[model samples]
Target: MSAWVFDLGNSRLKCAPLGEDGRPGDVLAFAHDGRALDAGWERALPMRIEAAHVASVAAPALRVALLEALSARCARIGLASTQRAWGGVRIAYAAPERLGVDRFLAMLAAHSRGGAWLVVGVGTALTIDLVDADGRHHGGRIAPSPALMREALHARATQLPPVGGHYREFATDTDDALASGCTGAALALVTCSGEAAAQLCGRPVPVLLHGGGADALRPHLPDAVHAPALVLEGLGCWAQVGRTP
Candidate 1:
């Protein structure tokens, strides 16, 4: 029997089948507009899956809808939630529940690689987390993502466009300036966080980038590894343990 894992984020919904080794297989993604999903989207899923493991940071409406759809096609369903510790990763949060499941999952995936890491997720938000080689989560930071920053600026100023324009060190036009500023802000945060993580962990850490907006920043940070399926990869681990929250 084959199982599937789902990662429902603020802007998109991603899913993948579990492989024989319990890792995620080819991933499929769909844009989420906070509306009811259509039958065509549902048809894209396997006709029948042995089980479904979901890690959702989306609104309740979409979460419930996706679960309802999976219930009919899956023998069992597992929902992921933040935990103090899982698979070797020890979260630093005093109240584990306050931590985002997506962040926790990304940390889990990073820890599984057996090294110190700085996990960065760039989507609706920019999230940074630090984990030592022994799986001790040092903590993390969150701020508006580059796209969100651009959107907020456009919303407030009206003169600035939310999208388009390439990033430059010294942008000449308004559009390019907007792009450079927002993206540079995010990069600065990541850079500062990396330096702090190095100090706290007593060594430099590798950066693992994920989420929808990661690509936009990848060229700037040449050392970071792009792992778009990171959340799903963590969900795969959650499924393997047969744990639900």
Candidate 2:
């Protein structure tokens, strides 16, 4: 059956047709603000689809906009939300709704592989979640992503540019310093979180990393499993087994 999966984040929108193989096929990405969709983005989607599934953390308005657009082209639509338990993974949060669906979905994707894991999503924000071999969500952390860190600094310090520089072990120049410091900060956190997750699970856990900023974070994190379509993969999981709340 033909379906579609949409993952709408704070800064971008990604969608793909669900292949007969039960996985998302080619991805279509579009730059988006909380309110704006890129020009011709709508044209990229197929004229009609059998079903559409969404994993959205964009503003409510943006969520509405995209889902509405999809509704016109799809016969049925599904919105995925954080569940108390999903695909063998039991959420750790006392109030599951309080946890971001993106994190929950990432955990689902990781658990699909059937092992203990530290799921790290580096996007507009850096989200680190821990799930064990037995499918227990131990919890996670949230911090400024490297880009967000740079943006925070730029917003406060006009002299500092938000973009540029390289990651150096010991940066000597300002540009390198900003890049190094920001990237290093995130890397350090991922390391610390990984260690913590390992301790909880009683061994080294595999790290499943995904998100927009993941490429920048991945170089420093050599051990992480690169799963670019993680959230979309989770959306596919939900489509197969999850029911809307």
Candidate 3:
């Protein structure tokens, strides 16, 4: 039987069918404004799915709307939550629920890859979580991702275009400067975190990067593995544990 997995972020919704092997099939990405989903949201999903697993970091109203829409087609629906421990990864959070589910699942997915790892998620926000070889979480940091930072700046000073151009180490123009500055901040954080993780674990820490904004940051992160479906993979891992009750 097939199961569907959905990862709802602030700016996008990604879904894929879970195969019998517990791996997700071809992914479908839908771009959404903060307020409304695209018309393709209805047509993109299958008419009937055996099960639906979701990990959402979107607004509550969006969550409710997506769930309500899926209710008609799915035989069962499971929502992933931030937990103290799962799939051998022990969270460092004193209050586990305070940790975002996206971060938790990303760690879970990293653990499955084996060895010490630094997980960085680049979306509306940049989030980094470190886990050692033993699967103990060492906590993480959250910052406005470069994209958000640019958007905020433009909101304050309308002269700055919110979207345009690309990254340059030494930008000669306004658009490139914005791109370089934002992406550079994310790169600096990831590289520094990777260095720290390596020192703590006494070996090089492989970095795993994911999320919508990952592409913008990837060129600078030569050591990182870009796993776009990381959270969805973790959702599949979540489905494997007997949590489907």
Candidate 4:
């Protein structure tokens, strides 16, 4: 049986189907505006999908729409949550239901590979979550993404110019300096937060970074493993649950 997976982040909606091997196939992405539902998504839906799984950090309305769409295309539809336990990881969020499903899934994906891990998702917002070697989630931190931070600065300050370009490591002067500094700040927040969590967890956690901004932070984070599709991998794992003996 095939499975359809959707990861609805604050910025975008990513969808894909899983093959029998539990790997993503036929991936498609749409803007998270809710208007994209009626667009050509039907054409993108695979045939013979038996189950559907979704992870969303958006409004309840958007989640409902996504589930309705998937239900129309599949026999079974499921919503992903931070509550599920997998491998050695057990979620420790004070309000597990309030925790972002994407963060939980990413942590699970990191843990599946084995070892203490720090999973960072850098999208509309930057989130850093930790999973210890014993599979216990030690919680995490969240901060504005570099883009949001830059935009906020430009929006609030009249003289500050809007900056746009590839994030560089070393800035020769002020222009590159500001851009690099903003980007560096975001990366530092994530790294420092992860490191702190690792220390609290009493283990050396290997960092797994994901999201669109991951590449920009990679140079500064020599210790981090880049996993662009970490959330998708987690979605695949969620889709497989309860399907086997």
The candidate that wins on TM-score is 1
The sequence of per-residue lDDT tens digits that candidate 4 reaches over residues 117-186 is: 8888888788888888778887778888877777788899846666754556787765576678788888
Q: Candidate 3, clashing residue pairs?
A: none
Q: What are the lDDT figures for the candidates, one per model?
A: 0.90, 0.88, 0.88, 0.77
Q: Write the per-residue lDDT of candidate 3 for residues 1-245, one digit (tens) a residue.
A: 46999999998999999888777889999988866677758788889888999999899988888998889898999999988888899999999999999999888888988888899998889999999888899989999999899999999999998888798989999999998888888888988998888888898888899988889888888778999999999888888874545
Instruction: Give candidate 1 regions above 4 Å deviation.
Output: 243-245
- For model 3, give the 10-residue run with minimal summed lDDT: 236-245
lDDT of 2 at 6: 92
Residue 230 error, candidate 3, Å: 0.6
lDDT of 4: 0.77
- How large an RMSD does model 2 have? 1.7
Give the candidate number with the greatest lDDT.
Answer: 1
**How does model 3 fare in lDDT?**
0.88
Comparing candidate 1 with candidate 3, which one achieves the higher TM-score?
1
Per-residue C-alpha lDDT of model 2 across residues 1-245, encoded as one tens digit per residue: 46899999999998888876557888888998679788779888778888999988999999998888888888999999999998788999999999998898888888888888889999999999998888899988999999999999999998999999999999999999999999999999988998887777788988899998999988877878999899988887778775435
